[model samples]
Target chain A: MLSKKQARAFFLGGTLVTFLIFIGLTIYSFSKGNDQSNHENITESVVRGKKIWESNNCMGCHTLLGEGAYYAPELTKVIDRLNMKYNGQGEEVIKSILMSPVPWQPNGRKMVAYEMTEQEAEDVVEFFRWIGEIDLNGFDRIVSPLAKEDNNN
Target chain B: MKYKSQKVAYWFFALSMLLLVLQLVYGFVMGFARIGFDNLHEFVPFNTARAVHTNLLVVWLLSGFMGAAYYIIPEEAQRELVNVKLAYVQLISLAVVGVVAVVGFHFNYWEGRKFLEIPRPLDFLVVINVLLFLGLILVTLFKGKRRTTTALVLSMGLLFAALLYLPGMLPFDSQVMDSFFRWWVVHLWVEGVWELIMGGILSFLLIKLTGVDREVIEKWLYVIVGLTFLSGVLGTGHHYYYIGVNKIWLIVGGIFSALEPLAFLAMALFAVNMYRKGEKKHPNKLALYWTLGAAIVSFVGAGLLGFAHTLPQTNLYTHGTLVTAMHAHLAFWGAYGMIVLAIISYSLPNMTGRKLYLTPRGRAAFWLSNIGMIGMTVAFGVAGVAQVYLERKFGMDFMLVQKEISIHFVVLIICASVFTTGIIMYIIEFYKHGRPTDEAMEVSIQ
Candidate 1:
């Protein structure tokens, strides 16, 4: 029979230990050597593109790194996936869609047309490229078939 | 009902109901959009609707929890709220901030970070609002004669929840880091401290409704919340695994997250055992239904369904797909949503001096909502599993796979309609209870 005091101790002690360990794990994961996030590769364009992505709430519809509403396509490897599909015109296609005045409706599912400038579109493309390069513990292959197909080839 | 100040909770509950209705509306907007009737695309895009839906859920649940705190604290502490007027001010400010952020979303005036979409400026307002809420709650609890474990646990949960929100506000140039910290707030709040709030409320309800010994119930409450943080703190790894983080998360998240269900399972068993062991069953059948339903359904939804997709193997396929949505819906509904409603159900009759728990409509609301939500879950699961197959497994085009799964949305809409009817009935019952009267404190004692 666990006493009330014992139960309280268990709760407090367990929480403290786990929280400390969680913090330690977080530090370990984010350490330079363990970093899979491509920290050094992040350029000014990638940062600006991320800003546009957030300001526009691209994640509301499209998923990045497999996190989002699942309403639109996953854009983690959009550059690679698109380049493979569009004969290396993937960046142009993306920019065109971003710069298009009208909504981009693929199979009647409408994406809010951002109607961005060429510069802004290029920034977004840079963001996508940066995102595509990061190692995602093999999830990029799961999301972009091109990655998997390339591997198979 | 024991104190006049407890009536402040009624207004907060009203706010919660209002926001919950708005959440459902946004949910329908997204659902209808899925089936290609995106007529509101120009004014309210899918992203806007999604941000609204999720943010509304967070607001409503927070409001509900605040209301529960307002009601429960005074009783547990043996005193009226220190300043009822200030509490009302807190409520109004909270509502204003929620409304402003919601309206801002329509105009692209949001930060667009999924759940934390409120713009940076509005995030400050939220912090102020929550700080005021916590101040009122903490001041009232400490000012009172007694500080029970239930009160301390509930307040601690509230305090930690506010602290966790700060992480989401941190600026990150890396999308990966942004998501990593975002889960620190979202995942930790939902899976970690929120369970403490749930446990606290469940402990309070069990003591009152079951006539269970307070010490016994409080002891188990500690154990339940203990299990929660033990597994849940480390379980944040699940979100980290594929989000450009190190591979350590894959192993850590897989093992710890698998242990997460034990907490929920323990909650279910505790609630059921408490009920069986209860010698004096209070007459609030409606509250009991919600309380027990919350426990059982959470085990199945949060525990079992969550387990279904939580593994690294399965999550590798189902991460961003409808499968996550499938688990998310039932989990939030069963765990957070139902507990809020349970607290409301239990507190309402006492506050209004209305013994309307015997009404058939209340029972209808319970069954219809549960059944409809279950149908919706099944619909999502089938579509999600199908999506994993056609899209992720078979490498079909995203749009093409979506077309194959669009039929599920139709089923979802039907179930949603059923679910809406139940909620409407529940709200109507809520409305029928009328306002909380100070005199009911005396009336309910009889």
Candidate 2:
């Protein structure tokens, strides 16, 4: 039993809301455009590693900074962890791990070979290094690899 | 013995309700565990329970929709369903596949995606079920007395659902390609095909209940189906933006998904207009709630939030967060779940030949469930924004952040518990008030 005036108001209100949403989205999209174009300062090695990552579909197995497949480890913080674990031999240790066939098993985790050339492995290590350097201060927290393993058990 | 389509629909409805109850229990158990993680061992872990919860929701909704279609199509077409045996067979196959898929999750035989977790074997069974369903629907429509607008759109939806699911099941070398096809099945079905079916069913029911003009309802259905497909097919781009797909997905998914709200808005307007112009009064108030609420919720939850994250840029921030979960919970429940409830409310009395009114307790239950849902939506939405702020703005340890966010889990659990109590009350009232004679009247009318 809505009056004509009320119906008109309703329609007008709906139109206003829709227009506001469109405006908000336009502004947001424009802002993100700036962010994407700001990546011109990225290193060549990182760019090469990104290509390799995409070509091999590494995201199908590994996650980078909480994004991608959860089948493998988080590579974003791998550089710092490798540095800490291998006593400052961050890049070399990562390269060796990728090149050398190491069988590491922790229940429910299947061993998969890292099939990459030495130079490709180095490039991936450099990618991780670059990601580690990106200021993640205002980024979503990556899923904890250890916690996921703990859950599986 | 002649097979009655009403009998089949009732049986399927009952079975769907049973599954729904079980799903709710699992949801509650999972919610509780989220609060007290130490209580449940890995034997029935959160991930497994979550897989069961989501998959069950999909299966039960499909079952209910299929049952409704089978019941309504024949009556609207003014003929018997072409193959009653095939309908029964489709039901059995779906039930078997659903059970195996759900059981497989508890046994750790899942593929590990949130909603698409059923293992390969169970997936094959589902594909078979879909094919059989499409075949039955198409054959029935072809052999029926006349083609109504509802029958045509519903049949088209069934056909598209089967076709879309096929590509997703195929093995593809590229994960990006696989992901694209997966969204084609999941997004297209819920947002696209299902909307068509729901619109058809809703229009049919409204025509019967309110004595609205068939022409008006049918026109609304046509517009809804058109909008659903036009916006929804391109809306698949929303998911593609972040998954390493081409950058074009950002523009396509964002702009089109933004337009998706217009469909829901139109649906709302249709309902409101019908109510305004109707010659006959709606017999049940609750049914009116279901009809109008579905339109509002789908508009706000699915349409608005859909726009919110449609932008590849915003999605970069919102993907995988609780914000996504909020959108999903509201949209699916509002659009599909409420529509099904509305359909059942309208048809049940006709099927049973009983004037069913919600008891005071039932009314209370309805309010409780509605309020609980609203609380959960707001709580989860706020929690998601908070998580985004804390995680992105502050370099908090990811695990620590999750633990901190456990507070929201507690709130959601409380809300779900209230909702569960409401559902239980509803079940009790349904048993007390539901009349089989009302259905006898409906059959006589046919």
Candidate 3:
């Protein structure tokens, strides 16, 4: 049985730990900087793809990492998946896949058409290609998608 | 007259349980689809199952809460319900609306949002039903002997629930604006107003079971209510970060939503501390289990995970994944489900005038449910982390990766099966043996 004073002390201790964790996370994220250039050197195509992504409100339909509308698939790893599926001819093949309105039938799940313009498809392909190069190992386990899959399996 | 309110409450409780069982079955089917996906051409597809699960959850919660409010309000106010017949009418209307919403989803007439997918007409009926329920509660308090803090807080919860839905129904030009107020309905109700209801019900149960000092319990209620509004209204900013809102939402949501957990943590501490200090002891062990379980689970689920996703940076990676589901599952069950259980455990004996304690089977069911919940939370939490990695770091095909990674869903389904088994055992126990006797008349004297 915890006394009132002991409970208060425990609470205060928890508050202190929580504050330290918060401060550490904030500082780490700030040090990492919000710039996209640190992980993947930004090319014109990548920048163009980002612009297209914003204009088309791709985030409204699909998530990149985990942040966006849950209506569509996450595009963060689209480049890699396409690369693996097409056997290493990376960007061009990914672009073709995005541009070609093939009726995607994966395990009988009918894929809906995204109706992207040729340029827009290229831009999305470029954006995904950029994400494929980033090193995301240091992020928190809860937010780190890779960490979750490895542990659960 | 007293028996009339009790009977009405019991009947509604039964109906709510029936819905709950249906919800669980649909939820299991949905979980299985996530894992197997062998037959997408089935009558109940994944989308249909998801809609049913979400809608059934909302209906059952409303029904259970209505029953709780109806039963407790009158007793706390020291008189019969002001309009008992209206209470029955409200329940019937709500049932009709619930059936329509669920069946509509089956026929593919859903609005496409997870919990808020009920058609517009059904949503309107639900709102009206809630308002009528609130009005009845208020009138009962007015006409009765006096007011208790529990009754007042519960009434306030009902009022806020109705008030929050209005903004959601308003016609907004921008989809962002529409989503903004939609959170007012969804987030505010679950994280905000629901806490108020939980606090009230928990306090009432504690007082009745343990004979704790009303003043102490009421003071805790006041603190919980204050923390709820203070944190909840501002905490709505958490949902705004990615919804095309201004950048300031990042700072506001991260900071304030972090504070929301403190309220629940404090409530947990308060309850446990009160139990330790109280002079009287509860006769029924299961009732005690509920009170403590509610506090502990709420602390872990609503408080801890809630804090994890509160920050904008974290939300940037954890949004819409299984992590959110983990938090919601535990929080809803801890805050609302446990409160309903506590109320039922307290009242069933009184209503039936029997000394009801959980049999050995009932005790096993309780443990199974707790274990299953923990398993589900852990599995989903890990799965969510995996999703962030594959999608964020590896740049994998989202759909293909999800297919590869749905093993976690299998674990969740297994856990749900374990939980269902527990529920079955509990039902059997309830039918075979009734309540404990000594405490049956404790509430009737008032």
Candidate 4:
């Protein structure tokens, strides 16, 4: 029994309300949540490292923050792995790999040894270090060693 | 064509077909690359191929929608396009921009944003191109004698789609901030505004093909529009989960995105009901097949499969897995892709003065593409589940998990080949239609 005008109004108004809720929630999260607070004191090196990351299109192969291609290992915990397994030689290991450019058959990694400067390699690894420090509360770390430590019941 | 200006649509559709071929070529490149055929890795790496593949999809679909508008707006509005020559200019400029952006990907000169890899400068050009397109469509719709519901819905969708792109262009320093806003462009487009476009185009096709009353069909349009907004607007939160956003999105996104299927379901029901109610049989059974298929398959793909991994707990393991790929391939193929094909199927004969409706080749194209895509979706699903178990749950090496799933890509390539064959046949038939003449619009198909 509703008029077409009524239906259209309900449709448009509902969309408006929903969109506003999204904006409101996202703004609240940014001001009072984990994402913005950690990034408030971003160092230049971390920022430079981010630029290095994008410029090299490392995301084309690697997943960061649980986003990007799944071809390579998730970089969310790369720094943790390096510290625990490589005795904090993560930067040198990553740099060597970038310079050598071959698929490590053991890991089945198909990453190209991207042509990057030594400085750029440092910046990229620095970026990873910055991300590692952020407490994601186990984002993409589901059932991993990190989660196991947190949930040891 | 009803108006001489309508002939311009043929060129846009032609451009769409050409770009579609290029899109498939890149798809094959990535498909082969995935199976360890790294021959083209040096020239067109997997990342570059993916960028090109996705961008080509967006460009070709835009071209198709533009073509549909050029053909539809004038007929719906009962007026010729305000400026035909400028439309040609817009098309040519669109081709130039698309070519430049695609080529830049090879040189690693892209923005590196998935589905938004075009650099900022080219984005500006895209904006201008869309502005020109909207100008033509909106002007034609408003100034004409009639203002149909279908026209308004289609134009609104186009206008909103343009406005949404601005958010993606805004710079964000924080990765969380950037990812948060990025979904506003990505999820909102496919799930929100694009559904509006689908609804509008669906209404038009149903009215024409079913020979049903426009009022009855437009009524369904309102319902579809309502459901799309109700579910899709909040569904943006689905991407917010696990992206360093508030934990609230876990509940908000899961609850909301879970409801997103309702919108697609309504669409399927709407199409089927309208189809059953209509007594008049339109000779263009091919168009009807596409029109109906788009509605039903969209529900299954976007609604059902998207639901499988949309919940927060499930998405935790499947966030960037091949599960997303499975949902993506079918959803995109079913919704926007098939809707564009529907309009092309309907308008081609009208524009070309050729009775190519219900041809055996057309039937084969529709079935093969659908069957092949469904098979590909299954292969991706099997691989995704295995990867989730081996890598995410069992904590195996990422490379080891990928090797375990590599066998699935062999099935994927085979299915994709069948899909490509269908598309090639469709294009060949499109080519056989020759050109549009002014007389075609007056000569209705029997």
Q: What are the candidates' individual DockQ scores? A: 0.92, 0.06, 0.08, 0.56
The most accurate candidate by lDDT is 1
Model 2 residue B264 distance off true place after TM-score fit, in angstroms: 1.0
Q: Report model 4's chain A TM-score.
A: 0.81
Residue-level lDDT for B373 in candidate 1: 95
Give the range of the ten consecutive residues with the poorest summed lDDT in model 4 chain B.
B437-446
Clashes of each: 0, 13, 18, 2
**Cα lDDT computed for each candidate against the true fold:** 0.93, 0.66, 0.69, 0.84
Residue-wise C-alpha lDDT for candidate 4, range B116-147, written one tens digit per residue: 87888999999999999999999999899899
Candidate 1 CAPRI assessment class:
high
Q: Against the correct fold, how does model 2 do in TM-score? A: 0.77
Worst 10 residues of 3 chain A by lDDT: A135-144
Best by TM-score: 1
A1-153, model 1: which lDDT tens digit per residue?
Answer: 999999999999999999999999999988989999998899999999999999999999999999988889999889888898999999999999999999899999999888899999999999999999999999988998789987788
lDDT tens digits, residue span B192-297, model 1: 9999999899999998989888999999999999999999999999998798999999999999999999999999999999999999868899999999999999
Top of the candidates by DockQ? 1
Order of the predicted models by TM-score, top scorer first: 1, 4, 3, 2
Off by over 4 Å in 2: A1-153, B1-3, B433-446
Q: What is the interface RMSD of candidate 1, in Å?
A: 0.6
TM-score of each: 0.99, 0.77, 0.77, 0.97
